[model samples]
Target: MTDQPPPQDQPPTPPVPPGNPQPQYGYPQAPPPPAPPQPGYGYPTAPQHPYAQQPGYGYPAQPVTVVAGSGGDTRRGENRTIALIILAAVVAIGLIIGSGVWYAGSSHGGGGTAGPGGGKNGTATVTGGKEKVPANPAADVLFKVPQPKTEDPSVPTAGSWLSGRVYAKSGIAEIIGYDPADGTKKWTLKFPGPVCAATERVTADGRTGIVYQPSMPTKTSRPGCTQVAAIDVRAGTELWSKSIGTGEFATQFRNVTVSGNTVAVGGSDGGAAWDIGTGKVLWQPKPGDGCSDAGYGGGPKLVAVRKCGTYGNRTLSIQNVDPTSGKVISEYKMGAGIEYAGIVSTDPLVVGADAGHSASGGSGVSDYFSIDNRTGRLLARIPVSGDAYEGECDTISQVEECKGVVAGDGKLYLATKERNEKKAHGSTNEVVAFDLATGKQTGQRAAAGDSFALFPLRMDGGNLIAYKKPPYDKGGQIVSVDGASFRSTTLMELPAAGADRDLQTDFQPGYSEYRYTQGKFFMAEPNVGKPIGSFDKDRNLFVAFGTRD
Candidate 1:
């Protein structure tokens, strides 16, 4: 059974009476009785349902026309005119922020065009196994972890990763690893308090970094996120746990990432790094010049977003730094009025920013700046309106957590906002590419068929791995799109009926974390809230689907 909250404009309905038989998905028999409510913090009033689709972040209602473009460098005068229009719109609307639909297209280029054939074939590379695209793809329920109880509605549970044969997930104050094939528990790592932040990347040797508090929060005392630790996901053990300072003088971190052998973290207290293997402090923040490091982006390379200047009048410098020596190799200074910038990719050095606060929706993007990281030279500035594109980023502190967009193979792949079909009844969407060098649409697009919305998951070699959200009665699909030819090959398909469909549809792409590997698809909630009522007590924290029985 599923529980949906009322729309924001309406009042919530009364809870269902007891003794009503709720339909159970996937499970052949009735679900077991609700577990005794666990002791945790949250709210004392009625619970807020977390599964209901919110308005501001996903598909919009009506579709607008995309702007036409020719693909190349946009003239300076044209750029100034576009910026003025965006600023005027924000002023007129008073900075509207939510998940709303809007159509977007580059004014410098026409629609995307297909590339040449003979592109590289896609492959699914897993640590312990190989996942090949099956001729007739089908999947079944592999396992499900029951949701942990909490009194508060908004608790932090923002970390998950797959290592070797174990799938690790975060809970209130603990991390649990489970067997990938079955639902049996492999190991558990407990923490003193809730996990404040986590990196989505894992090292080649199966090590990852996380930030947490030294102790649990209480009514009279609240602890800061000051501790950093490196854990072995495959072995389910902590390699090292350390922190600098204590009490009020300690440095509090809002983000953490693993780059090579360095575990870097940063926030309002500035930035710091530690050796992953020895737990030695590599460098500490130097206070002066009214400048501080906001955060760092890791994976393949290390890039820092440094902020300097007074309140409203500030400048940002994107710096490519060495992980061991903390030396800046190259730097790119952004234009005025751009307060915050999110790192999309380090190697290609793609940055997303809302110039003059022109972005309407909560996507935290108005234009993409592609730069030459080695030379610190500007490559191309790609304008992506939030109204038309479906990418997201944390414009505040977490610099590297962008989603719904992929940067690979010298191009940027983005999913267009879902629009109603002209000939069909349901809505559909498409994936388009942009050249990082010319800032022009590639003219190649991968259609999502009727009634499905496509989202880019990750890059597989030269191919693009994407997820297709199914309609009300159909199961979701995973397909691999050729990077050059734009052809899609079905990799796996879940069951359309029973409990599997219920679990699949419950975890949407933008709001949940998905990992597909070795013919298995894993969906886990980034955070868990208090159950709305007894009917929702059986909601799972995570669910796994596999091609094999």
Candidate 2:
């Protein structure tokens, strides 16, 4: 079905086609706009633009021609060259302006672009929508010195913040009001006796603060007991003062805690809560023996750290006391073998700690520890060093002490102290942050800025860190490291050497001390005596004292 075509001999006419290829018509004659700022764009050798053949001052626009036969077909030669130049100029100008703006921002800094603190740069390039918190070299916004209005500053009470500001007893024995600004003397109320080191225990609520006077056990039928006093912050006055116990427990003071409108203190006999203003005993539970420190989860709930027996049988006595009616709504026991067995309360989840059991009794505990605030359940237990700080878990090893305090983040910061076995004469300080929910190390630990000791106090919540001051030093400062990474740019040299007694926290989460004042960094020296006073940190001021005489 295919037709055959005759084969033709090679024709010589093809040689004529090589001569003068007729001026290409309607062909792409223009090279790209100055070839752009691209990698491989340049005028081809011998040129593609028709202007390459033109002899002129500047390359003439490729000759545009019209072919009559084609009816105005373009001889497209460098036609778009002008357009390319203009476009590039516009882009160049835009880039130049942008670069100018960038340079200006970088040179002048202070446009709020870079915070003096925290972490930020000007241009940012790209940062999430976090405005970021800035820091100042000066903590002065929250720190002001209270000045003296009376006969020079006389009494330095351990200043504390309850519902409001309170300055506990000072030496020569007195409780006075120190201004939250300038450490000035606001008012003076004399107390009964000489306060001991960390002697004055205060329990604070949202609306009030209570101070307790602990009793030193005598060799009588009883050992010692504690007294209680409640102060109303808004009204600025002592609401009530009562002797909570008699016998040996007299002269003994328990942990005083206030939540909502009631204040509570505990003892070996039982624990009691009282009305905020009336001093009427709100709820008093009997047969609560060996009870030491106590606290309440806000509202009508109270939990006492009870030392149940002579052998370190600790118990979490959870009680619901009616602040309005002083009624015991509920009661329950949490565990046995509790040391310093108080409730680490944040509501719903109550974490507490205690010494499980002591074979004998010269008074030594496993370590300071904490429990679930609600269930009285055990959490991670870290080892504690001196009675200076609380200890925790030794279930697996004796080196476990719940030292570094945890904030509400369920992050427990534990500080471990041991007489460096390597250098028995020297000691080793370790602070580690652990996830309470998992009991695993967060892998972050803090030590001394210098070669010193780290004392950790209680933890708050998502924010804050706690640490301790080195003992035996003349004037030492206690550090509470709770912030994710708390770093103090400035730590002033302390003035005297005496134990920091009045420093404490209100037992809530994310709560910051505002560090307005400080207690004596170091306890008094053994042979040489130190100042006869203690200090307190109110809002932002240090309410302290010394004799004008």
**lDDT values, one for every candidate:** 0.66, 0.31
Q: Write the per-residue lDDT of candidate 1 for residues 243-357, one digit (tens) a residue.
A: 7677777778778898899899877656778888888787665533355667888888888777665434455667777777666666677665565677888877898776654
lDDT of 2 by residue, 280-325 (tens): 6655533322332233444224443332333222223444334444
Clashes of 2: 81
- Candidate 1 Cα lDDT to native: 0.66
The residue-level lDDT of candidate 1 at 539 comes to 81
Q: Model 1 residue 431 lDDT?
A: 83
Best candidate per TM-score, number?
1
Poorest lDDT segment (10 consecutive residues) of candidate 2: 91-100
Compute the lDDT of residue 542 as modeled in candidate 2: 32
